[model samples]
Target: SQFTLYADTSSRRPGFSKAAKPDLAVPLYEKFMARCRERGFQVEHGEFGADMQVDSRNDGPVTILFDTEGNL
Candidate 1:
């Protein structure tokens, strides 16, 4: 089993006075869940504050930690 972990940060929102915080987790989470289901891997969601976690796979898990408070 090949597992992988990824993280991304962005400040891109259109039609705004300034760059806004990105919706960093949703896309990644959806894709990760779909892939996990397709590949038949046991996927789990971490606790509220946990950054990332993985179990029984060659590649790690995908985790996105958003700093919503840092938006400017």
Candidate 2:
């Protein structure tokens, strides 16, 4: 069995100049979801341009971060 998580985030919005950051990400996000579905991934996502909130808990007091800027 395999499991993975995905999130699409952005910080831009056009046309509706009064919009906020991360507003123009819906189209890109939808494409991602479609591709994942085609690849047989368990799909779970909110509607495009919808406000969302997420929470998480860790098992221990240690956390690690990865910077993939130039790893390729």
Candidate 3:
């Protein structure tokens, strides 16, 4: 449950100001994680604003992206 900032840009470079500020985002994220735990999930996560090295060896998994209108 790593909450990375949702950054986007019109051109080639990236812009990060679109993501929710930590002051607001962190509390909501914490609430969500708490709900998941309350539902008996064994959740593992990283720091909210820290760089982490994630290593995975699993086979390919399906990935999807969507906008607010639900179109990819």
Candidate 4:
């Protein structure tokens, strides 16, 4: 209820290009969210492909993704 999610829709597998099929990624993400929900993590998000400016001010180290994207 207090956390945020900033999921990235950009999917790039080792053998795939930037032009590879993204058709499965969305569903996979949905399933992942479903599992998370099953485990009781309330989920929220932003515009899937939109650029965002983070305004966090935490002292702990933060983990960024390979796409330099954020997810919460």
Candidate 2 accuracy as lDDT: 0.51
lDDT, candidate 2, 1-72, per-residue tens:
011123222222113444434544556666778899999999886555555565667889896443344342
Ranking by TM-score: 3, 4, 2, 1
lDDT (0 to 1) per candidate: 0.50, 0.51, 0.71, 0.54
Tens-digit lDDT string for candidate 3 (1-72): 543647674545557788888899889888888999999997777788777777866576864343544344
Ranking by lDDT, best first? Answer: 3, 4, 2, 1
lDDT of 3 at 34: 92
Which run of 10 residues does model 3 get worst, by summed lDDT?
63-72
Where model 4 places Cα greater than 4 Å from the true spot, the runs are: 1-21, 61-72
lDDT of 1 by residue, 1-72 (tens): 122233233443323334222365456666767799899887775442344555654465785455545664
Quote the lDDT for 23 in model 1: 62
Model 2 misplaced regions, further than 4 Å: 1-24, 59-72
State the displacement of the C-alpha of residue 31, model 1, in Å, after optimal TM-score superposition: 1.1
List candidate 1 stretches off by more than 4 Å: 1-22, 47-72
In terms of TM-score, the best-performing candidate is: 3
Candidate 4 TM-score, C-alpha based: 0.45
TM-score per prediction, in order, is 0.31, 0.42, 0.62, 0.45
